[model samples]
Target: MTFTLATWNINSVRLREGLVAKLLGEEAPDVLCLQECKSPVEKIPLEQFAALGYRHIVARGQKGYNGVAILSKTPLEDVDGRDFAGLNHARHVAARLENGVVIHNCYVPAGGDIPDREANVKFGQKLDYLSEMRDHFRAQRPHKAILVGDLNIAPREDDVWNHKALLKIVSHTPVEVAALAETQEAGRWVDITRQDIPSGNLYSWWSYRSPDWDAADKGRRLDHIWATPDISGAAHSSRVLRAARGWEQPSDHAPVFATFDL
Candidate 1:
């Protein structure tokens, strides 16, 4: 069966409920994974999404902070969110579909502006978070899994608009990139989006600091969809919905999508 799965860091589900509805109507992805929902699970505005035919959902949320969710048109079985211990943040949620495809959604912490861990507590947390993630997946050894979310690090040179210029930047820093790579290797995750669109300049996030983001085009591939090697061959047709970044009051990040023949 071929189906489309999309990941977007909506920034704030409550703020972009309308855009979410719009995306559901327009893109019609079979499964949608969202990060940075910034709303409690109980206040996720499920009714609006339910109206769009996504009747099933599994999420971990907190008020005005990090949250992750999976909305599916197909039925889902909730997977325990406690897989990664010690890193207790509303950063992950997972579900197994009726077809036995497991979807793991996550929102990795954005290491702050400063690259120095000692100078920035957030940067330290980000590194520790990724370390814990690497250990957890290494132990579990996922198979046939689809991992999606705003991973918050742009690992590839092509993933950032000006790689040289952004090398020292938080997301493009060597340390951050190495940490992200370790996690990917541990999980045996194939970056489906990059696997499909392997050439020049791919990005899912633009900083709000830029006045003319589109014209300046300073963006980063912060969001991602990675599948296990077992299901990697099933992945195809990936794209970043760049226009969503131009939508009124849109989130800094846009949706990235991929299709799979499961």
Candidate 2:
């Protein structure tokens, strides 16, 4: 079976329901995973998405903070969610398709501005969250699974707009990159996006603070789609929908896509 999957950090699914609808209406990926939904699962505004033919959904949410969800045209079975770092935040959820393909949708904490964990609690939480992820995958050894989300760390030099400029920045800091790399290594996850489009500066998020986000093109590959190495070769055609960031009232981040012939 072949299906297309895309992941996006919608910021707030309720507030930006229109944009979500627009993407569903236009792009129509077979499965869509969203992070930062910021709404309770019961209040996710599913009717509109259902009307658009994406009737299957599995989500974990909170009142106004981190949330992750998966909406699929294909059937899905709700799997467990994990609260990494022992933070107990609504940041991760999993679902399985009829094809037995498990999808893990996550929203990694954005380590605060300061890189020093001693100076920032959130920064500490981010590192701890990644640490737990590494341990989880190490213990369980996932297979035929895909992990997608706003991981909040850009591990590759070409994944950011400026490597040196962002070296000390939270998302591109050396420590955070090393932590994320360790987690990926533990999981044996292949970055589908980078695997397909290997050479160049690629970004999935642009800061809202930059008024001329497009012209400046200052962005980071904060979001990702990763598959277990066993199935990584089956994945192809990965790309970021950069135009989505230019849409009316768009999220700071854009959607990323990958096609899999499983």
lDDT of each: 0.92, 0.96
RMSD of each: 1.1, 0.6
Give the number of the best model, judged by lDDT. 2
Q: Assess the local accuracy of residue 39 in candidate 2 as a C-alpha lDDT between 0 and 100.
A: 93
* TM-score, per-candidate, Cα-based: 0.98, 0.99
TM-score of 1: 0.98
User: How high a TM-score does candidate 2 get?
Assistant: 0.99
Candidate 1: stretches off by over 4 Å: 83-87
Show where candidate 2 strays beyond 4 Å: none
Candidate 1 lDDT tens digits, 1-262: 7889999999999999999999999999999999999999999999989989999999999899988899999898998685343556799898998878899998888988999999998899889889988998999999989999999999999999999999899999999999999999999999999899988899999989999999999999999999999999999989999999999999999999999998
